[model samples]
Target: MPVPVVSVAQMRQWEQASWSAGRTEAAVIARVGACLAAWLRRHVPHNDRILILAGKGHNGDDARAALPHLQGRAVDLVEVRDPETALPDLERALARGPDWILDGLFGIGLNRPLAEPWCRLIERINQARSRIVSVDVPSGLDADTGRPWGATLRATCTLTLAAPKQGLLHPAAHTFTGRLEVIPDIGLVPCPIQSELCWTLPEDFLDWPPPRPVAAHKGTFGHLAIVAGSTGYHGAAVLAARAAQRARPGLITLITPASVYAVVASQLQAVMVHPWSAAHPLPGRYTALLFGPGLAAADLPAEIPATLARLWQEANVPIVVDASALDHVPRGPIPRDALRVLTPHPGEAARLLGTTTNEVQSNRVAAVRALSGQFGGAWIVLKGYQTLIGRQHGPIFVNPSGNPDLAQGGSGDVLAGYLAGLCAQPPLQGDPERLIRYAVWQHGAAADALSRRHPAWVVEDLVRTLGRVAPHRVASTARPATPTTPP
Candidate 1:
C-alpha cells in the first residue's frame, strides 16, 4: 500500500488541527522527541558520543525534550542562535568528536534562506565527519521543492515525523537525505489531499500474484503481446521478451519487424516470435499489449496509428507505451475505455509535451501531472532518479527501490516488459494500476538485489535476478485489505 506524502503547509495544518484538538505543542514535541530517542537507542550504540544541536523553534523544543530519554549516552547539548557566541561551545563539542550529531535546527516550515549564524552553523555541521541525523527535514532544505537554501546539512539518516514530505522524495534530495524513516506515532494525521507521493516497500509484494489455486494452469495466468524492436535494435525485443518470461507470464508473443524475427527468435525458446507485416494481424486474445522498445518511427507502417487504435478499441486491454513508440502516440485525448500507461524518459516526455527536457526535470511533479491530464486519464511513468508513477486521478507514487545501477541501456525495455508481464497475470490483469506499480517496484528491487552481489550488473543479470525477488510466498486467506485513498 502507498503511504501519504504532504507539503509543509499541509503538515502545518495537521499540526494546528492536532493542537486545536487538545494536543498541546509540548505534548507533540515530547512525543516526537521520545520517538527519536527510541530510534537512536535501537540504531546507535550506547557507548557512542552524541551531540544534539538545538535551535530556536518547536524543533529545538523537541530536541530538548528528547534529552531525558537518552540518559545512558555521553550527550552534549548546544543551543545555537548566534554563531559567534556558540562557536566556542560548538567547537568544544566537535573537538570531543561525537559519533552522531542530531540536527534539530529547522522543521518542515522553513521557507526563507538561512541567515549568517545558521548558515555558519550548518556549514560547520557539514564539515564535520560525524554522522548527522536530522529531525523532520534537513536544516536548509525546502520541504516543498526539495531544494537546498544555502548550506544544507547532509544527513546520514532523516527520521521524518509522521508522513514523508514531498521534497524528500525529489531526485535532488537523495544525497541530503540518505536513509529516510517515518515515525508514525508522532501525533500526525493524514492531510486531506487527493493524491500523495509514497515510498514503495518490499512487503507490498505479498499478494503480487496471490495464491495460485490448485486448479490453475498455464492458460490461467493470461498471455502478453509485445510489439517492439527493429532491424538494428533486435536486442531490445529480446530483453523485453526475456524479462516478461521471467515474470512468469503464462504466454508471451513477440511481434517484431521481419528483419529481426530470426535474431529475436534465436534468443528465446519460451516466447512465440512473429514477423510483423501489414498482412499479419496481431493476436486478438492477448491480455495486454506492450508497444515500443527499439521500434523506430521510420520503421513503422503508415497504418500504424489505425492498427494501434483498432487493437485498443477491439481488445480493450491495458497498453503500455514506451521507447520509440512514444513518438507515435495519438495527439487527441486517450480513449475512455482504454487502460493505458506511458513510460517515458525525460527526453521522450519533453517530446510528447512539446517542451524541453530541462523543463521536465526541473519540475517533475507538474510535468507528469500535465502529461496525465493531456492523455485524459493515462498512467504516466516518468523515469528518472526518483521514478514517478502518476495516474489521472491517483496520487503520484515514487519508486524508492532503484539505484544508479539502472542508468544503463535496455533498463527501460526491461521495465516495460516487466509491467506488461505483470498485467498479463490472472490476479493483476484487471487491476492495471496495481500491476504497473508492482512491476516498477519489482524492476527496481531486482536491480537493487543485483547491485549488492555485483558492483556493476548488465541488463541480462537483472533479468536473471528477477526470480529471486519475485513473490513466491502464499498469502493467508485473510490477507490485509488493499489500501485505498479516501474518495
Candidate 2:
C-alpha cells in the first residue's frame, strides 16, 4: 500500500489500531528500538559518544527503548522533563559534548511554542557541534504545521516512524527534518486507516508502454494541445510544448495568439505551433489539452471561458488546466464525466481556493485538497517544494524528489506539458492518475539529477534530461516524425 502522511490525530488512531490488533506496548517499543539501533549501528560511528535527551512522553520512550542496542557505546541519558530541573543536566550534556545527540524531547505532540528553558535547550542543540538524529520529529517543531515553536532542533537526519508525518514533509520543515528516513518495519501495519496526505515515491511511475510494438506509430502515443502564451510570456508556451514532446506524445500543438506566434513557433521543432485565431474556433482533435501557461488579461477574453465550458460539456478528453486557466476550472463538485487536472502554484492555488498564499504554504497538504473540493478536478498538482498532487476527495500525494534548483519560473509549464504528453498516450489511457503522478515524479527526478552536476539550470534544460531520467518513456521507440498541421 502507498504510504500515508498522517497527522497527529490520525497517528494516535494508527497506534491505537495497532494495539487493538494484539500488539503489546513492549513488543512495539522493542521493534522501534531495534530499528533505530540498527540504523545507528550502520551510520553512527562506533567511536562517537551518544547523548540521549530523553523526555517523559511518547517520543522520549521511543528514544530510551533503543538504549539496549548501543550497549557497549558511550551513552548518556539525561531525563529532561521540567525546565528548572533539566537545566543542570542540559548544561552538563552540552559541556560533555557528545558527538551524536538523539533528540526525543517532543515529536508530533508539540503544537504550541516552546517554553523559555526548552527554547534555550533547542537553541543550544542548534549551536552544538554534534550531528543529531531526531526521533519521530525534531523537538520544538510543530509536526503538523512544519513551523518552529521558539527554536527547533537542526538535525542531520530524522528517523521518522512508519510513514512520514505531514509537517515533516513541509518545505519549511526541511531544515529541521534533515534527510528524512522512514523506519518501515516498526511492528505496525498501516492498513484500515486513511490519511488526507501521502508521500509519493519514484516507484509511483508504474513502468510504462512495455517496449513498443514494431508497428507503433506517432498516433500510438497520443496528441496534446497547449493553449498557452501571451505578448510577454511566449517562452512558457514553447517550454510546455517541448516538455510534452519529451513525454513522447505523438503530436503537440501550441495554440497561441498571433502576436506571440513568431517567438513560440521559431523555438519549437517537433511540436507544431498553430497561431490561434478567435474566428477559426478552438481545436478539438487532440487527445489531451494543456491551458494557461503564460496567459494575461489579453488571453482570458469571454471566449476563453465559453470555449472551456463548451469543451467541458462535449469533450471526453482529459484537460490539464494550469497557471491563469486554473481560475476558471469547474467550481464546487465537478461533473461525474469531467476529467480535468489543475496544476497551480501556491499563489494560483490560493486564488482558486480564496485563501492567502501564506495560509496555503503553511499547510500545503490542506491547500491541495481544498483545491480539489473548491475548484473540482480529477487531479490538482499544488506546485511547490515537494509539490503536492491531490485527487478530488482523495489522498494528497507529495512528491519526494526534486531540489530547490527547480524553483524557477517555467518549471510548472514543463510539468503541465509532461503530464499532458503522458495523458495522451496509449498505456493506461483510461486511468491517467498513475501516468499523471509519474509525470510529476519524473519532472522532479530530472531536476534532481541535473542539480547534482550543475549548480544552476533553467526550465528548457528539463526536456533533455527527461530522456536520460526515464529513457523508457522518451526513447523507448523511434518517435514518429515531427507532427504535421492539425486538421
Candidate 3:
C-alpha cells in the first residue's frame, strides 16, 4: 500500500479543490462517516457507549455526523465550546457514563498551545479508562513538526483523514498517536499533491544490489574497508566490520590504530584488518569505504580531508563518513562529483550546517538537502525517530520503523557498517544515493526484527541480525552492464 503522508495546509488545499469542483463537504463527510461507523461497528460492536470529545471544528462535525448512524447504541458527546451553540445530542453524550472517547477536539491547523477548558478536559479524558481515538491528528501536536503544543490526548488509534500526517510519526508525537490509519475521502477532489509522509518498507528496496551468480568468488560481493576505532572504541570498528560481513559483502577490511588491531581481528573472524598509521596508505581496490565511528575528533583536521581526498583519487569507491568522521568534515562547499554518504544526528547535523539543533528539527527536509548539496550531492541520512533520508533535491524518505529500545550506543556504527556492505555488493554499484536509501530501510528492518523478540536492543545484535533479515529479491539473473532504475 502506498502511504500518502501530507501536511494540514496541503489537505485543506485538496479539500478546497474538491469544493470548487462541486462536491459538497457534507456529502464527503457522510461517505467517510459511514465508513467510520462500519469500522466502529465491526471493531467495537453494538451497545458499547462511545464518548466523542468534539471541538467547534470540522473534525467535530465528523464525529457528530457519525452519531446518527450509531443507531440505538449509547453515544456520549462532550462539546468543547466558547460562545456555545446547542447540539442536544452532544449534551446527552457529555452527561453519559464511561465510554470509548473519540478525540476530535483539534486538527493539525492548531499552531498555538491549547487553551483552558479544553486543556482541563484533555486531562479528564486521559484519566478515563475508555480507549481514546483521535479523528485527524492528536489535538496538541504541531502538524508540521510533531512537537506537542502543551498537553495532547493519548489515543488507542488515530483515524487520520485523506492521508497520513507527517506529525503522527514524529518522535515527539509518540505519546498521543497510536496505530495510525489513513482513510481516503475518495469522493473528494484529487489534487496533484504529494504527501510529506514518504517512507520505504522492506519491499520498496527490492531492486537494490541485485542477486549473486552461483559461481561467484570472494571478490564478487565487493571489498569493504572500514576506518574506525581508537584505543577504547574498538567495539565501534568491530560492530561496523561485522555488520558489513553479515550483509554478505565479498570481503571486509578494517583500518584502525595499531593498539587495537589484534583485539578487533580476534573478535571479528571474517573481516581483515589494516593498521591506521602515518606509514600505511589505503588500498586502491576497495569497493566501498566507511570512515569515522570512534575516530578521535582531535585528529580529524589533519587526517580526514587527506583520507577523503585519497579515497576519491585512488579508487572510485562509495564512501560513508559517520560518527566522529563527520567532525572530520564540517558543513561547507565540498568537492564535486564524489561518491559519499553522511549519517549524522541532529546535533551533528547542526554543527555541520552551522545552526542549532532546533533549526535542523524545524525543517529536516531543508537541512538534509543542504548537507547533501554542499557535499557533492552525497546521500544524507538524518538519524532520528522518523529518520529522514536526503538527496540533492530534498528528503526522499522518512523511515517509520524500529523502536525506542534501539536507543543505544553503537547503533550508528552498525548502520555505517550496514551501508558499507550494501555499497560493496556487485548489483548495488557505486551509487551513493541508492545505497543510502536501501541501507537505511534494511537497517531499520533489522532493528524492527530485534525489537519483536527482546528488550534493551544492542547495536552488536544488529550486526548478527543482518543475515537473518532478508533483502528484496528479484529474478533477473543477468548482472546488467548498467544500473537498473529503482522500481
Comparing 1 with 2 on lDDT, the higher-scoring candidate is: 1
What is candidate 1's TM-score against the reference?
0.81
| Each prediction's TM-score versus the true structure | 0.81, 0.75, 0.72
CA RMSD per model (angstroms): 5.9, 9.3, 8.2
lDDT of 2 by residue, 405-453 (tens): 8888888888887888887776547766666677887888798778867
- TM-score winner: 1
Q: List where candidate 3 sits over 4 angstroms from the true fold.
A: 1-5, 15-117, 129-133, 140-151, 155-191, 195-203, 206-217, 277-283, 297-305, 312-315, 330-337, 392-396, 430-432, 467-487
lDDT for each candidate structure: 0.78, 0.75, 0.71
Superposition error at 233 for model 1 (Å): 1.9
Across residues 177-269, which tens digit of lDDT does each residue of candidate 1 receive?
876766655654444443456655445677665677789888888899998888788899999999988878789999888778888889889
Candidate 2 vs candidate 3: the lDDT winner is: 2
Worst 10 residues of 3 by lDDT: 474-483
Summed backbone clashes in each candidate are 0, 0, 3
